[model samples]
Target: MSASTPFVKMNGAGNDFVVVNALERAFTPDAGQVRALADRQTGEGFDQLIAIEPSTTADAFMRVWNADGGAVETCGNALRCVGWMLLQASGSDKVVIDTLGGPTTARRAGPDRITVDMGPPRLDWREIPLAEEMDTRGIELQVGPIDAPVIYTPGAVSMGNPHVVFFTDRLDDAFVTGSGSLIEHHPLFPEGVNVGFAHVLAPDRIRLRVWERGAGLTKACGTGACAALVAASRRGLTGRRAVMVVDGGELDIDWDEASGHVFMTGPVEVERTGTLSL
Candidate 1:
């Protein structure tokens, strides 16, 4: 292992990341290494660690690791940051990024802004892969009590990753963390799930908070935002397009009616460049 490696710290809508160009350095971090780097107090803290690798089918391959050192499928925010980096390097307007989920296209929308075609939402219960068959529009999961649950009938969707969204009028921290943590490990989700607490302000706007499966609560979750919108639309709570207001910032999410593809547009910020002692 190398003593040190260069890294680029970036964020998209406040979902921060530590990006290592494996295409340049050829580095892979094991679970322990990833956990070390995820330490906020002692190491370079980030919601996720992105390794940029070579891909034959796409412009590049993105490997994602959550703060808990779990290797996940896709990360929408990281894709935007990586897309911006690749676009700046190649000076191209569009780029295709391959992930564990599948291939996605990203295009330059404006200064520091990128729009990613995040493919279509997986609607089937088998796709979301719950423990058993059920309706994804509103699952049977509930919090609090069976007769009078605090939150019930959450919608499920897989945006490259598993998520269950609970629509409510309250957006308090306690409800989000408490209920979210409980649902993330629910037996229904065999692979675990990201839990989203969505408060719909209008047909086109929602305030959301997410408890990421492997990363706990984060400031922003790009895929979570997409999942929330899709879930809301399926439940007829909102239309296909909305502005998702997260703790870190806002994301514009549009589920295309023609293509059935979800497009997420957000801003990416280069926080800093540094070296990590591994």
Candidate 2:
């Protein structure tokens, strides 16, 4: 390691991550390097890594990496971290940042909390890119004992990523941890998927826990919230507007009945700032 890398550690609804700035120098960290950085004990520790680089669009170009060193198109929490950085950088309340998935706009709502418009949701089976095409809405997927009797149908939605949400009778704490990974990498999801176990508590509220693709388990996933709301709505379990409770915290989710798109509103919290040594 030549020098310690300056970085920001943040989390949105408990999806912890480290944001790295690549503008000054490049480390070209491999999977092992990324793992070291994401180590909960020894490394900087995070679920994912966000590298900010010089960009032709907006203020910067952001690259996303799972703790496993795989690339992902979008990350909602990192967007707010970027927004936080942008607010400090440009002295503005809002910023437009481009992602490989698409462009994202975020606004500083409170001290360190931010609200991000995660763009529109993609609901096509082809978009979710399931191995087989079927109705993404209220589709059948099986894993463990849940089967059709337990989870029945789930809504498949993509926010530049794939998600499968089970609107069950209750938020099974055990299943969320035990069965989540089984569903996330199911053969049905060719590119793999983020798995959510959701239980509708009321007309506009639900509880959730997620298993994220490539990153294994995390505190929360913003795109997972959007997908859960959409899935619940399709199953007639909840209204278009709902609040999803995640391990990290809470996220307000709304699926526009008219537009067929889902919107997720949440907060991003910057825990600390530090420099990574290689």
Best by lDDT: 1
Worst 10 residues of 1 by lDDT: 169-178
Per-residue lDDT of model 1, residues 203-234, tens digit only: 99999999998898899999999999999999
Local lDDT at 66 for model 1 = 98
Candidate 2's residue-wise lDDT over 35-102, tens digit each?
88888899888888998877677677778889887888888767777777877888977778888888
Whole-model Cα lDDT of every candidate shown, in order: 0.94, 0.79
Q: What TM-score do all the candidates reach, one by one?
A: 0.98, 0.90
TM value for model 2: 0.90
Q: Please identify model 1 stretches exceeding 4 Å from their true place.
A: none
- Candidate 2 lDDT at 248 equals 82
What shift in Å separates residue 92 of candidate 1 from its native position after superposition?
Answer: 0.6
